[model samples]
Target: MDASFDALLDEAAGAPVDGWDFSWLDGRATEQRPSWGYQRLLGERLSAATAALDLQTGGGEVLAGAGPKNFPPTLAATEGWPPNAARATRLLHPLGAALVTHQQGTQLPFCDGAFDLVTSRHPIAVQWPEIARVLTPGGSYFAQHVGGRSNVELTAYFLGPFEVGDSREPEVESAQARAAGLEIVQCRNERLRLEFFDVGAVVWFLRKVVWAVPDFTVERYRERLRELHDHIAREGAFVSTTSRTLIEARKPAP
Candidate 1:
Protein backbone atom coordinates (compact mmCIF):
# COMPACT_ATOMS: atom_id res chain seq x y z
CA MET A 1 0.00 0.00 0.00
CA ASP A 2 2.83 2.38 -0.80
CA ALA A 3 3.63 4.25 -3.99
CA SER A 4 5.40 1.17 -5.32
CA PHE A 5 2.34 -0.94 -4.70
CA ASP A 6 0.12 1.76 -6.23
CA ALA A 7 2.23 1.75 -9.39
CA LEU A 8 2.04 -2.03 -9.56
CA LEU A 9 -1.71 -1.97 -9.09
CA ASP A 10 -2.06 0.57 -11.85
CA GLU A 11 -0.07 -1.59 -14.23
CA ALA A 12 -1.52 -4.83 -12.87
CA ALA A 13 -5.06 -3.72 -13.58
CA GLY A 14 -4.39 -3.67 -17.32
CA ALA A 15 -5.75 -7.13 -18.09
CA PRO A 16 -9.02 -6.82 -20.02
CA VAL A 17 -7.12 -5.17 -22.85
CA ASP A 18 -4.66 -8.06 -22.82
CA GLY A 19 -7.05 -10.88 -23.66
CA TRP A 20 -7.79 -11.64 -20.01
CA ASP A 21 -11.50 -11.18 -19.60
CA PHE A 22 -13.25 -13.66 -17.34
CA SER A 23 -14.28 -15.87 -20.22
CA TRP A 24 -10.81 -16.02 -21.68
CA LEU A 25 -9.00 -17.02 -18.51
CA ASP A 26 -11.76 -18.41 -16.32
CA GLY A 27 -13.67 -20.08 -19.12
CA ARG A 28 -10.65 -21.94 -20.39
CA ALA A 29 -9.37 -22.74 -16.90
CA THR A 30 -12.79 -24.13 -16.02
CA GLU A 31 -12.48 -26.73 -18.76
CA GLN A 32 -8.97 -27.72 -17.70
CA ARG A 33 -10.41 -28.68 -14.30
CA PRO A 34 -6.83 -29.25 -13.32
CA SER A 35 -6.28 -25.48 -13.35
CA TRP A 36 -9.29 -25.28 -11.08
CA GLY A 37 -7.25 -27.02 -8.43
CA TYR A 38 -7.68 -23.91 -6.33
CA GLN A 39 -11.47 -23.89 -6.41
CA ARG A 40 -11.76 -27.65 -6.15
CA LEU A 41 -9.77 -27.50 -2.92
CA LEU A 42 -12.15 -25.03 -1.29
CA GLY A 43 -15.41 -25.62 -3.16
CA GLU A 44 -17.48 -27.60 -0.72
CA ARG A 45 -16.86 -25.40 2.34
CA LEU A 46 -17.36 -22.17 0.41
CA SER A 47 -20.60 -23.36 -1.17
CA ALA A 48 -22.08 -23.95 2.25
CA ALA A 49 -21.09 -20.63 3.81
CA THR A 50 -23.69 -17.96 4.56
CA ALA A 51 -22.07 -14.53 4.76
CA ALA A 52 -18.97 -14.08 2.63
CA LEU A 53 -16.32 -11.45 2.03
CA ASP A 54 -14.08 -11.43 -1.05
CA LEU A 55 -11.08 -9.22 -0.51
CA GLN A 56 -9.19 -7.64 -3.41
CA THR A 57 -12.06 -8.36 -5.72
CA GLY A 58 -9.93 -8.16 -8.91
CA GLY A 59 -12.26 -9.51 -11.59
CA GLY A 60 -14.59 -11.02 -8.99
CA GLU A 61 -14.44 -14.48 -10.57
CA VAL A 62 -14.75 -15.85 -7.07
CA LEU A 63 -17.63 -13.46 -6.45
CA ALA A 64 -19.41 -14.67 -9.57
CA GLY A 65 -18.68 -18.26 -8.62
CA ALA A 66 -19.97 -17.86 -5.06
CA GLY A 67 -23.39 -18.66 -6.61
CA PRO A 68 -26.90 -17.57 -5.51
CA LYS A 69 -26.67 -16.27 -1.97
CA ASN A 70 -29.99 -17.38 -0.46
CA PHE A 71 -28.33 -18.67 2.70
CA PRO A 72 -27.40 -15.11 3.93
CA PRO A 73 -24.33 -13.96 5.87
CA THR A 74 -23.72 -10.37 4.77
CA LEU A 75 -21.85 -11.11 1.58
CA ALA A 76 -19.53 -8.27 0.63
CA ALA A 77 -17.02 -7.62 -2.13
CA THR A 78 -13.98 -5.50 -1.30
CA GLU A 79 -11.87 -4.22 -4.16
CA GLY A 80 -9.10 -1.68 -4.83
CA TRP A 81 -9.04 -0.06 -8.26
CA PRO A 82 -11.90 2.22 -9.33
CA PRO A 83 -12.42 0.52 -12.69
CA ASN A 84 -12.34 -2.91 -11.09
CA ALA A 85 -15.04 -1.75 -8.67
CA ALA A 86 -17.23 -0.80 -11.62
CA ARG A 87 -16.53 -4.13 -13.33
CA ALA A 88 -17.25 -6.02 -10.12
CA THR A 89 -20.53 -4.13 -9.83
CA ARG A 90 -21.49 -5.26 -13.31
CA LEU A 91 -20.46 -8.83 -12.55
CA LEU A 92 -21.81 -9.19 -9.02
CA HIS A 93 -24.80 -6.81 -8.75
CA PRO A 94 -26.95 -8.98 -10.99
CA LEU A 95 -26.35 -11.67 -8.43
CA GLY A 96 -27.72 -9.11 -5.90
CA ALA A 97 -24.47 -7.48 -4.81
CA ALA A 98 -22.99 -4.00 -4.47
CA LEU A 99 -19.31 -3.98 -3.59
CA VAL A 100 -17.40 -1.65 -1.29
CA THR A 101 -13.91 -0.37 -2.10
CA HIS A 102 -11.78 -1.55 0.80
CA GLN A 103 -9.73 1.14 2.52
CA GLN A 104 -6.05 0.21 2.56
CA GLY A 105 -3.58 0.15 5.43
CA THR A 106 -4.10 -2.11 8.46
CA GLN A 107 -7.68 -1.27 9.25
CA LEU A 108 -10.74 -3.12 7.94
CA PRO A 109 -13.98 -1.11 8.35
CA PHE A 110 -16.26 -3.97 9.24
CA CYS A 111 -17.18 -4.71 12.85
CA ASP A 112 -15.51 -7.63 14.60
CA GLY A 113 -16.97 -11.01 13.79
CA ALA A 114 -18.91 -9.65 10.85
CA PHE A 115 -18.49 -12.52 8.40
CA ASP A 116 -18.73 -16.30 8.36
CA LEU A 117 -16.47 -16.79 5.34
CA VAL A 118 -13.68 -14.73 3.76
CA THR A 119 -12.17 -15.42 0.36
CA SER A 120 -9.54 -13.95 -1.91
CA ARG A 121 -7.55 -14.92 -4.99
CA HIS A 122 -4.00 -13.70 -4.62
CA PRO A 123 -5.17 -10.51 -2.91
CA ILE A 124 -2.30 -8.43 -1.54
CA ALA A 125 -2.27 -10.76 1.51
CA VAL A 126 -2.06 -7.83 3.86
CA GLN A 127 -4.46 -7.13 6.75
CA TRP A 128 -4.67 -10.60 8.22
CA PRO A 129 -5.66 -9.29 11.65
CA GLU A 130 -8.25 -7.11 9.99
CA ILE A 131 -9.59 -10.20 8.24
CA ALA A 132 -9.62 -12.14 11.49
CA ARG A 133 -11.20 -9.21 13.31
CA VAL A 134 -14.10 -9.26 10.89
CA LEU A 135 -14.73 -12.99 10.82
CA THR A 136 -17.51 -14.54 12.90
CA PRO A 137 -16.68 -17.38 15.23
CA GLY A 138 -15.78 -20.58 13.41
CA GLY A 139 -15.43 -18.61 10.20
CA SER A 140 -13.07 -19.56 7.37
CA TYR A 141 -10.69 -17.71 5.08
CA PHE A 142 -9.90 -19.30 1.72
CA ALA A 143 -7.21 -17.93 -0.53
CA GLN A 144 -5.14 -18.96 -3.56
CA HIS A 145 -1.98 -16.97 -4.05
CA VAL A 146 1.51 -16.89 -5.53
CA GLY A 147 3.60 -18.40 -2.83
CA GLY A 148 6.87 -16.66 -1.90
CA ARG A 149 9.76 -17.44 -4.19
CA SER A 150 7.11 -19.93 -5.25
CA ASN A 151 7.90 -20.00 -8.93
CA VAL A 152 11.31 -18.44 -9.07
CA GLU A 153 13.00 -21.01 -11.24
CA LEU A 154 10.52 -20.75 -14.09
CA THR A 155 10.59 -16.98 -13.86
CA ALA A 156 14.35 -16.69 -13.85
CA TYR A 157 14.58 -19.15 -16.66
CA PHE A 158 12.22 -17.09 -18.77
CA LEU A 159 12.93 -13.48 -17.81
CA GLY A 160 15.36 -13.33 -14.93
CA PRO A 161 14.72 -12.84 -11.20
CA PHE A 162 14.27 -9.07 -11.29
CA GLU A 163 11.35 -9.46 -13.67
CA VAL A 164 9.48 -11.77 -11.30
CA GLY A 165 8.03 -9.96 -8.33
CA ASP A 166 5.04 -10.97 -6.18
CA SER A 167 4.22 -11.00 -2.48
CA ARG A 168 2.92 -14.40 -1.46
CA GLU A 169 5.01 -16.51 0.91
CA PRO A 170 3.07 -19.34 2.52
CA GLU A 171 5.03 -19.07 5.73
CA VAL A 172 4.46 -15.32 6.06
CA GLU A 173 0.78 -15.32 5.06
CA SER A 174 -0.23 -18.40 7.03
CA ALA A 175 1.75 -17.21 10.02
CA GLN A 176 -0.11 -13.92 10.10
CA ALA A 177 -3.45 -15.66 9.71
CA ARG A 178 -2.57 -18.04 12.52
CA ALA A 179 -1.40 -15.20 14.76
CA ALA A 180 -4.82 -13.67 14.22
CA GLY A 181 -6.19 -16.88 15.78
CA LEU A 182 -7.06 -18.96 12.76
CA GLU A 183 -6.30 -22.65 12.50
CA ILE A 184 -4.58 -24.21 9.51
CA VAL A 185 -7.59 -26.09 8.25
CA GLN A 186 -6.29 -27.20 4.88
CA CYS A 187 -3.61 -26.47 2.28
CA ARG A 188 -3.27 -27.50 -1.36
CA ASN A 189 -0.34 -26.56 -3.52
CA GLU A 190 0.98 -27.69 -6.87
CA ARG A 191 3.06 -26.46 -9.75
CA LEU A 192 0.56 -25.62 -12.46
CA ARG A 193 0.79 -24.68 -16.12
CA LEU A 194 -1.01 -21.65 -17.60
CA GLU A 195 -0.23 -21.26 -21.28
CA PHE A 196 -0.03 -18.18 -23.49
CA PHE A 197 0.27 -18.11 -27.26
CA ASP A 198 3.77 -16.70 -27.11
CA VAL A 199 6.16 -14.69 -25.01
CA GLY A 200 4.32 -11.48 -25.91
CA ALA A 201 1.27 -12.93 -24.25
CA VAL A 202 3.44 -14.15 -21.41
CA VAL A 203 4.98 -10.71 -20.93
CA TRP A 204 1.57 -9.15 -21.05
CA PHE A 205 0.32 -11.68 -18.54
CA LEU A 206 3.25 -11.16 -16.19
CA ARG A 207 2.28 -7.52 -16.28
CA LYS A 208 -1.39 -8.21 -15.65
CA VAL A 209 -2.21 -11.72 -14.45
CA VAL A 210 0.65 -12.34 -12.04
CA TRP A 211 1.10 -8.70 -11.02
CA ALA A 212 4.85 -9.17 -11.45
CA VAL A 213 6.05 -6.37 -13.65
CA PRO A 214 8.30 -5.07 -10.82
CA ASP A 215 7.59 -1.34 -11.35
CA PHE A 216 9.51 -0.36 -14.45
CA THR A 217 9.28 2.61 -16.81
CA VAL A 218 8.46 3.05 -20.49
CA GLU A 219 12.10 2.40 -21.49
CA ARG A 220 12.44 -0.41 -18.98
CA TYR A 221 9.25 -2.07 -20.16
CA ARG A 222 10.61 -2.02 -23.68
CA GLU A 223 13.83 -3.57 -22.44
CA ARG A 224 11.95 -6.28 -20.60
CA LEU A 225 9.78 -6.87 -23.63
CA ARG A 226 12.82 -7.36 -25.77
CA GLU A 227 14.34 -9.69 -23.23
CA LEU A 228 11.16 -11.77 -23.12
CA HIS A 229 11.13 -11.94 -26.90
CA ASP A 230 14.67 -13.12 -27.04
CA HIS A 231 14.03 -15.79 -24.44
CA ILE A 232 10.96 -17.03 -26.25
CA ALA A 233 12.82 -17.32 -29.55
CA ARG A 234 15.50 -19.30 -27.80
CA GLU A 235 13.24 -21.50 -25.71
CA GLY A 236 10.16 -22.18 -27.83
CA ALA A 237 6.71 -20.84 -28.73
CA PHE A 238 5.39 -20.80 -25.10
CA VAL A 239 6.51 -20.25 -21.56
CA SER A 240 5.65 -22.27 -18.48
CA THR A 241 5.13 -20.49 -15.16
CA THR A 242 4.41 -22.06 -11.80
CA SER A 243 2.44 -20.75 -8.80
CA ARG A 244 1.58 -22.58 -5.61
CA THR A 245 -0.32 -22.33 -2.34
CA LEU A 246 -4.08 -22.54 -1.95
CA ILE A 247 -5.03 -22.52 1.67
CA GLU A 248 -8.13 -22.47 3.87
CA ALA A 249 -7.84 -21.60 7.51
CA ARG A 250 -10.51 -21.28 10.18
CA LYS A 251 -11.03 -18.66 12.86
CA PRO A 252 -11.19 -20.11 16.37
CA ALA A 253 -14.65 -20.36 17.89
CA PRO A 254 -15.24 -17.91 20.69
Candidate 2:
Protein backbone atom coordinates (compact mmCIF):
# COMPACT_ATOMS: atom_id res chain seq x y z
CA MET A 1 0.00 0.00 0.00
CA ASP A 2 1.35 3.44 -0.84
CA ALA A 3 1.97 5.52 2.24
CA SER A 4 0.13 8.34 0.50
CA PHE A 5 -2.94 6.15 0.26
CA ASP A 6 -2.70 5.74 4.03
CA ALA A 7 -4.25 9.16 4.59
CA LEU A 8 -6.90 8.46 2.01
CA LEU A 9 -7.61 5.10 3.53
CA ASP A 10 -7.64 6.63 6.97
CA GLU A 11 -10.04 9.33 5.89
CA ALA A 12 -12.27 6.68 4.43
CA ALA A 13 -11.58 4.00 7.02
CA GLY A 14 -14.79 2.56 8.44
CA ALA A 15 -16.58 5.40 6.67
CA PRO A 16 -19.64 4.21 4.80
CA VAL A 17 -19.16 4.69 1.11
CA ASP A 18 -21.49 7.23 -0.39
CA GLY A 19 -20.53 5.38 -3.56
CA TRP A 20 -19.92 1.66 -4.12
CA ASP A 21 -17.69 -0.87 -2.39
CA PHE A 22 -17.18 -4.60 -2.18
CA SER A 23 -17.86 -4.66 1.54
CA TRP A 24 -21.55 -3.91 0.97
CA LEU A 25 -22.29 -6.50 -1.69
CA ASP A 26 -20.91 -9.62 -0.03
CA GLY A 27 -19.09 -11.10 -3.06
CA ARG A 28 -22.34 -10.98 -4.94
CA ALA A 29 -22.03 -7.72 -6.88
CA THR A 30 -21.54 -9.56 -10.15
CA GLU A 31 -22.88 -12.95 -9.16
CA GLN A 32 -26.49 -12.24 -10.07
CA ARG A 33 -27.72 -11.81 -13.60
CA PRO A 34 -29.87 -8.77 -14.48
CA SER A 35 -32.35 -10.71 -16.61
CA TRP A 36 -32.25 -7.36 -18.43
CA GLY A 37 -28.88 -5.90 -17.53
CA TYR A 38 -25.68 -4.32 -18.81
CA GLN A 39 -24.10 -7.61 -19.90
CA ARG A 40 -25.76 -6.77 -23.16
CA LEU A 41 -24.21 -3.31 -23.03
CA LEU A 42 -20.76 -4.85 -22.77
CA GLY A 43 -21.76 -7.03 -25.69
CA GLU A 44 -19.62 -8.64 -28.34
CA ARG A 45 -20.32 -5.65 -30.59
CA LEU A 46 -18.80 -3.22 -28.09
CA SER A 47 -15.90 -5.58 -27.47
CA ALA A 48 -15.32 -6.14 -31.16
CA ALA A 49 -15.38 -2.45 -31.99
CA THR A 50 -13.26 -1.47 -29.01
CA ALA A 51 -9.64 -1.78 -28.13
CA ALA A 52 -10.75 -1.29 -24.56
CA LEU A 53 -8.91 0.52 -21.80
CA ASP A 54 -10.41 -0.42 -18.45
CA LEU A 55 -10.00 2.27 -15.80
CA GLN A 56 -9.86 1.57 -12.07
CA THR A 57 -9.69 -2.13 -12.81
CA GLY A 58 -10.26 -3.84 -9.50
CA GLY A 59 -9.65 -7.56 -8.88
CA GLY A 60 -9.55 -8.03 -12.69
CA GLU A 61 -12.92 -9.69 -12.67
CA VAL A 62 -14.22 -7.28 -15.33
CA LEU A 63 -11.11 -7.80 -17.45
CA ALA A 64 -11.46 -11.58 -17.55
CA GLY A 65 -15.19 -11.49 -18.08
CA ALA A 66 -14.72 -9.28 -21.16
CA GLY A 67 -12.75 -12.01 -23.00
CA PRO A 68 -9.05 -11.23 -23.38
CA LYS A 69 -8.71 -13.03 -26.72
CA ASN A 70 -11.59 -11.23 -28.34
CA PHE A 71 -10.36 -7.74 -27.52
CA PRO A 72 -7.10 -6.17 -28.67
CA PRO A 73 -3.87 -7.83 -27.61
CA THR A 74 -2.89 -4.48 -26.19
CA LEU A 75 -6.06 -4.18 -24.18
CA ALA A 76 -4.91 -2.67 -20.91
CA ALA A 77 -6.19 -1.95 -17.40
CA THR A 78 -5.22 0.82 -14.95
CA GLU A 79 -4.97 0.28 -11.22
CA GLY A 80 -3.32 2.34 -8.48
CA TRP A 81 -3.62 0.05 -5.50
CA PRO A 82 -0.51 -2.10 -5.57
CA PRO A 83 -2.33 -4.88 -3.81
CA ASN A 84 -5.28 -4.67 -6.17
CA ALA A 85 -2.91 -4.48 -9.12
CA ALA A 86 -0.99 -7.54 -8.01
CA ARG A 87 -4.14 -9.42 -7.22
CA ALA A 88 -5.75 -8.46 -10.53
CA THR A 89 -2.66 -9.45 -12.52
CA ARG A 90 -2.28 -12.75 -10.73
CA LEU A 91 -5.96 -13.41 -11.08
CA LEU A 92 -5.99 -12.72 -14.81
CA HIS A 93 -2.54 -14.00 -15.78
CA PRO A 94 -3.96 -17.36 -16.78
CA LEU A 95 -6.21 -15.60 -19.27
CA GLY A 96 -3.20 -13.93 -20.96
CA ALA A 97 -4.27 -10.66 -19.39
CA ALA A 98 -0.90 -9.80 -17.90
CA LEU A 99 -1.55 -6.64 -19.93
CA VAL A 100 -2.74 -4.87 -16.78
CA THR A 101 -0.79 -1.78 -15.65
CA HIS A 102 -0.54 0.25 -12.46
CA GLN A 103 -1.97 3.75 -12.75
CA GLN A 104 -4.40 6.13 -11.11
CA GLY A 105 -7.93 6.78 -12.36
CA THR A 106 -7.54 10.56 -12.17
CA GLN A 107 -4.55 10.66 -14.58
CA LEU A 108 -4.40 8.39 -17.59
CA PRO A 109 -0.91 8.33 -19.11
CA PHE A 110 -1.99 7.69 -22.68
CA CYS A 111 -1.86 10.05 -25.65
CA ASP A 112 -4.85 11.73 -27.22
CA GLY A 113 -7.10 9.26 -29.05
CA ALA A 114 -5.15 6.28 -27.75
CA PHE A 115 -8.01 3.80 -27.41
CA ASP A 116 -11.24 2.78 -29.06
CA LEU A 117 -13.04 1.99 -25.84
CA VAL A 118 -12.82 2.83 -22.14
CA THR A 119 -14.69 1.16 -19.32
CA SER A 120 -15.03 1.77 -15.62
CA ARG A 121 -17.07 -0.05 -13.01
CA HIS A 122 -18.35 2.47 -10.48
CA PRO A 123 -15.03 4.20 -10.06
CA ILE A 124 -14.48 5.75 -6.65
CA ALA A 125 -12.44 8.44 -8.37
CA VAL A 126 -14.33 9.39 -11.50
CA GLN A 127 -12.39 11.43 -14.04
CA TRP A 128 -14.53 11.15 -17.13
CA PRO A 129 -12.97 13.96 -19.16
CA GLU A 130 -9.50 12.58 -18.62
CA ILE A 131 -10.89 9.26 -19.73
CA ALA A 132 -12.55 10.93 -22.70
CA ARG A 133 -9.34 12.69 -23.72
CA VAL A 134 -7.47 9.42 -24.33
CA LEU A 135 -10.08 7.83 -26.53
CA THR A 136 -10.38 7.68 -30.33
CA PRO A 137 -12.89 10.14 -31.70
CA GLY A 138 -15.27 7.43 -32.83
CA GLY A 139 -14.70 5.28 -29.76
CA SER A 140 -17.17 4.46 -27.02
CA TYR A 141 -17.20 4.45 -23.22
CA PHE A 142 -19.10 2.19 -20.84
CA ALA A 143 -19.52 1.98 -17.11
CA GLN A 144 -21.57 0.21 -14.47
CA HIS A 145 -21.54 2.63 -11.59
CA VAL A 146 -23.43 3.04 -8.36
CA GLY A 147 -26.36 5.36 -8.79
CA GLY A 148 -26.89 8.31 -6.51
CA ARG A 149 -29.83 8.04 -4.07
CA SER A 150 -29.03 4.39 -3.41
CA ASN A 151 -29.31 2.29 -0.23
CA VAL A 152 -31.26 4.82 1.74
CA GLU A 153 -33.20 2.41 3.92
CA LEU A 154 -30.26 0.21 4.85
CA THR A 155 -27.86 3.07 5.31
CA ALA A 156 -30.33 4.94 7.46
CA TYR A 157 -30.79 1.85 9.56
CA PHE A 158 -27.12 1.12 10.01
CA LEU A 159 -25.69 4.60 10.32
CA GLY A 160 -28.55 6.46 11.91
CA PRO A 161 -27.03 9.91 12.16
CA PHE A 162 -25.09 9.88 8.92
CA GLU A 163 -26.15 10.50 5.35
CA VAL A 164 -25.82 7.04 3.86
CA GLY A 165 -26.03 7.60 0.11
CA ASP A 166 -24.17 9.67 -2.45
CA SER A 167 -26.32 11.57 -4.92
CA ARG A 168 -24.73 10.54 -8.21
CA GLU A 169 -27.69 10.81 -10.52
CA PRO A 170 -27.41 9.13 -13.91
CA GLU A 171 -28.68 12.25 -15.55
CA VAL A 172 -25.94 14.21 -13.81
CA GLU A 173 -23.21 11.82 -14.87
CA SER A 174 -24.62 11.63 -18.37
CA ALA A 175 -24.78 15.38 -18.51
CA GLN A 176 -21.19 15.57 -17.39
CA ALA A 177 -20.17 13.09 -20.06
CA ARG A 178 -21.90 15.24 -22.63
CA ALA A 179 -20.19 18.36 -21.33
CA ALA A 180 -16.91 16.53 -21.74
CA GLY A 181 -17.79 16.05 -25.42
CA LEU A 182 -18.84 12.43 -25.14
CA GLU A 183 -22.19 11.69 -26.68
CA ILE A 184 -24.58 9.71 -24.62
CA VAL A 185 -25.53 6.49 -26.32
CA GLN A 186 -27.53 4.75 -23.65
CA CYS A 187 -28.11 5.01 -19.91
CA ARG A 188 -30.01 2.73 -17.56
CA ASN A 189 -30.82 3.04 -13.90
CA GLU A 190 -31.82 -0.27 -12.33
CA ARG A 191 -32.85 -1.14 -8.84
CA LEU A 192 -31.25 -4.08 -7.12
CA ARG A 193 -32.56 -5.69 -3.97
CA LEU A 194 -30.51 -7.64 -1.47
CA GLU A 195 -31.75 -9.66 1.45
CA PHE A 196 -29.71 -10.13 4.59
CA PHE A 197 -30.13 -13.26 6.66
CA ASP A 198 -29.47 -10.94 9.58
CA VAL A 199 -27.98 -7.59 10.39
CA GLY A 200 -24.49 -8.95 11.02
CA ALA A 201 -24.73 -10.77 7.74
CA VAL A 202 -25.71 -7.50 6.12
CA VAL A 203 -22.75 -5.64 7.63
CA TRP A 204 -20.34 -8.37 6.60
CA PHE A 205 -21.77 -8.32 3.10
CA LEU A 206 -21.61 -4.54 2.92
CA ARG A 207 -18.00 -4.45 4.10
CA LYS A 208 -16.95 -6.92 1.43
CA VAL A 209 -19.45 -6.11 -1.30
CA VAL A 210 -19.52 -2.33 -0.91
CA TRP A 211 -15.85 -1.62 -0.38
CA ALA A 212 -16.80 2.06 -0.62
CA VAL A 213 -17.50 2.35 3.08
CA PRO A 214 -14.79 4.41 4.79
CA ASP A 215 -16.08 4.53 8.34
CA PHE A 216 -16.97 1.23 9.91
CA THR A 217 -16.62 -0.19 13.39
CA VAL A 218 -16.99 -3.94 13.61
CA GLU A 219 -18.48 -3.83 17.10
CA ARG A 220 -20.85 -1.00 16.30
CA TYR A 221 -21.91 -2.63 13.07
CA ARG A 222 -22.30 -5.96 14.80
CA GLU A 223 -24.57 -4.55 17.45
CA ARG A 224 -26.80 -3.02 14.82
CA LEU A 225 -26.61 -6.26 12.88
CA ARG A 226 -27.85 -8.17 15.89
CA GLU A 227 -30.77 -5.83 16.26
CA LEU A 228 -31.48 -6.22 12.58
CA HIS A 229 -31.35 -10.01 12.72
CA ASP A 230 -33.86 -10.16 15.53
CA HIS A 231 -36.14 -7.74 13.78
CA ILE A 232 -35.92 -9.48 10.42
CA ALA A 233 -36.30 -12.96 11.85
CA ARG A 234 -39.43 -11.83 13.56
CA GLU A 235 -40.68 -10.06 10.45
CA GLY A 236 -39.57 -11.97 7.37
CA ALA A 237 -36.45 -10.66 5.68
CA PHE A 238 -34.55 -7.41 5.66
CA VAL A 239 -34.64 -5.74 2.29
CA SER A 240 -31.86 -3.44 1.24
CA THR A 241 -31.97 -1.66 -2.05
CA THR A 242 -29.35 -0.18 -4.35
CA SER A 243 -29.72 1.70 -7.59
CA ARG A 244 -27.08 1.01 -10.22
CA THR A 245 -26.50 2.79 -13.49
CA LEU A 246 -25.04 1.58 -16.75
CA ILE A 247 -23.82 4.31 -19.04
CA GLU A 248 -22.73 4.16 -22.67
CA ALA A 249 -21.30 7.09 -24.49
CA ARG A 250 -19.25 7.79 -27.59
CA LYS A 251 -16.79 10.38 -28.82
CA PRO A 252 -17.75 12.01 -32.12
CA ALA A 253 -16.73 9.66 -34.93
CA PRO A 254 -13.65 10.89 -36.68
Task: Tell me, by lDDT, which candidate is best.
Answer: 2
RMSD of 2: 7.7
TM-score, per-candidate, Cα-based: 0.75, 0.78
Candidate 2, 1-254: lDDT as tens digits: 33432332343345543322245445322333344455445646345754667777777776666675556655777777666777777766776554456455446777899888888776765687887898899888888887875666666776665654344888888888998999999888877776654444455455545543446555546456556656766876677677788888999986
The positional error of residue 217 in candidate 2, measured at the CA in angstroms, is 1.9
- Model 2 TM-score relative to the real fold: 0.78
lDDT of 1 by residue, 1-254 (tens): 23432343345345454211545343112211235555544455556877778788776666576465332445778887787777887787777655888766757768888889888776655677888888898998888766666435535644555643344656666777788788988666666565443333543455554544445333446555555455555765344546567788888886
- Which 10-residue window of candidate 2 scores lowest in summed lDDT? 4-13
In the order shown, the candidates' Cα RMSDs to the true structure are: 7.1, 7.7
> Clash totals for all models, in order?
3, 30
Candidate 2 Cα outliers beyond 4 Å, as residue runs:
1-35, 43-46, 98-105, 161-167, 209-213
Poorest 10 consecutive residues of model 1 by lDDT?
24-33
